[model samples]
Target: MTIAFISDIHGNFEALKAVLAEIDRMRVAEIVCVGDVVGYYSQVNECCDELRRRGIPSVLGNHDWYLGYGGFCTRSRSVNECLVYQRKVITSENVNWLRAFHLQMQMDTVRIVHAGWSDPIDEYLTNPSEDYFARLSGTHFVSGHTHVQSIHRFGGKTYCNPGSVGQPRDGDPRAAFATFDGETFALHRVAYDMQKVFDRMEAAGFHDYYYGGLKTGAKNLRRLAD
Candidate 1:
């Protein structure tokens, strides 16, 4: 069975729609989300509702935790600003759905989490070493927190990050996702109408400071001087 893995879909419906459309074309058998269904953008409800409608299972992400459980993102005020806006517009039912997400999930040989196993909803699993993968309990592991798409192999174990569906930061502005065909994994990128997202953000009273990095997929969120 072929499975599609998506993560960090921080409410960019345009990106999500494009990714899902591509996944549809591939006729993928199953789709799983690593999480962050809400945060950093508008249209949180659309993203959540689409996932719920498709019955896609997701692990809990830090952003989802912040909004669902009520907490501030101490690391990035921009994240908190987006969360504040999202909270006002998201449906209570979707909030409940976000609350129901698990920190990690295991499906046969595949292990999935929104971030590192040690800190499932918050850790950034970048630059993982062989020793790191050795401690993991599965043949195939998947997580997404850094918004960078990559695949690593250590011994017989494999680790994959599907990247960000909404806020990709790997120097590629396109939407990012991945697919696994049991034996191997593949990362994929597709372009979406980012202008539409920008327009929506502006309509919602946000400035370019909120979405300037999307065009180039900068490593950090863009500031006015950037």
Candidate 2:
């Protein structure tokens, strides 16, 4: 089965639309989202509605937790501030969906999580070694959170990250995603209309930095993909 994986959408409807179009062109059997469906952008409700409409399975992201559960303080002070601002504008339905999301999912050959399987929703395994993969007990482990797209082979297992679809932090402005065709994995980056998103953010009256981040894909005053 060909499964297309995308993550860290962060509520950019334009980016998600472009990615879905590309996925249709690829004729993927299924589309799986690695989460962070809300946070950082202005179209949280639309993004969540679209994901639900498409019947995509998703794991919970840190941003989703903060927005839904009101516990961003436990994650990071800066993230807390961002979530606090987002909460004021987010709709009630989207918040409810995020609150009920799962942290991890296990499929036949693929294990999906917003972060590492060991730590689930919170910990990030950016450079998990051979020992880490050996302990996981899955042929393929897919995760996203760091917003850097990479594929790692350790022991007998393969680890794949699709990066961020809307808020890509890998130094590339193009939206990043990945596809797994049972045996092989391929990363894809697609260009979208950034100005359109920027205009929306402006009209919504979001923080200036929020819209600027979309243009550069940088966060926390750091360049993309620190």
Candidate 3:
């Protein structure tokens, strides 16, 4: 079976739409999103509705927790502000759906989540250690936080981060995801009409930095190199 893993959508329908288009062309049999379905950008409802319509099994990310429960997280002020805004605008049904997301799911050999295994919902792993990877019990443990695409191997198992769909920070400046056939997994970064994304952000009154990051994928370029 070929499974597609996508995460950290953050309400950028353009990016999500672009990635899904590519996935449709691939050999994907099952698709799952490790969350953050509503944060940073403004089309929270559109993003959530699409996922709900598609029936993708998604785990809750830190931003999703904030939106679902009116709680605080370690995210930046701008991100928290975006979540605060989404809290007012998201439909009640969608909010309930977000609340129903699990922190982790296991499907045969695949272990899935939105963050690290330790804390699950809030931990961010930029370069997770092999020991940490070993602790996860699966042939493939998949997660998406830190907005970077990578895979760490320990023994015969693989730890994969599909990167961020809405807010990729790996310096490639494109929407990111991963696909797994029965044998191996590969990462993909797809380009979209980012100007349209910028226009939407502007219309929504999001800060300029949000659009700037999408334009350059310049966030933490140094950390990505390390």
Top-TM-score structure, candidate number: 1
Better of 1 and 2 by lDDT: 1
Candidate 2: how many backbone clashes? 0
Model 3: per-residue Cα lDDT over 109-181, one tens digit each: 7888888888888777877787877765668888887888998777898888998888888778889999877
Put down candidate 2 lDDT per residue, 3-78, tens digits, no spaces: 8999999888899999999999988869999989987777888899999888887899878887888865464454
Regarding lDDT, does 2 or 3 come out ahead? 3
* Tens digits of lDDT, candidate 1, 63-103: 89998999878877777888889989988999999999999
Clashes of each: 0, 0, 0
Would you list the C-alpha lDDT of every candidate in the order shown? 0.91, 0.81, 0.82
RMSD of each: 1.9, 2.3, 2.8
- Pick out the ten consecutive residues of candidate 1 with the lowest summed lDDT: 217-226
Candidate 1 has an lDDT of 0.91
In model 2, the Cα lDDT at residue 202 comes to 79
List the candidates' TM-scores in order: 0.97, 0.91, 0.93
Residue pairs in collision within model 3: none
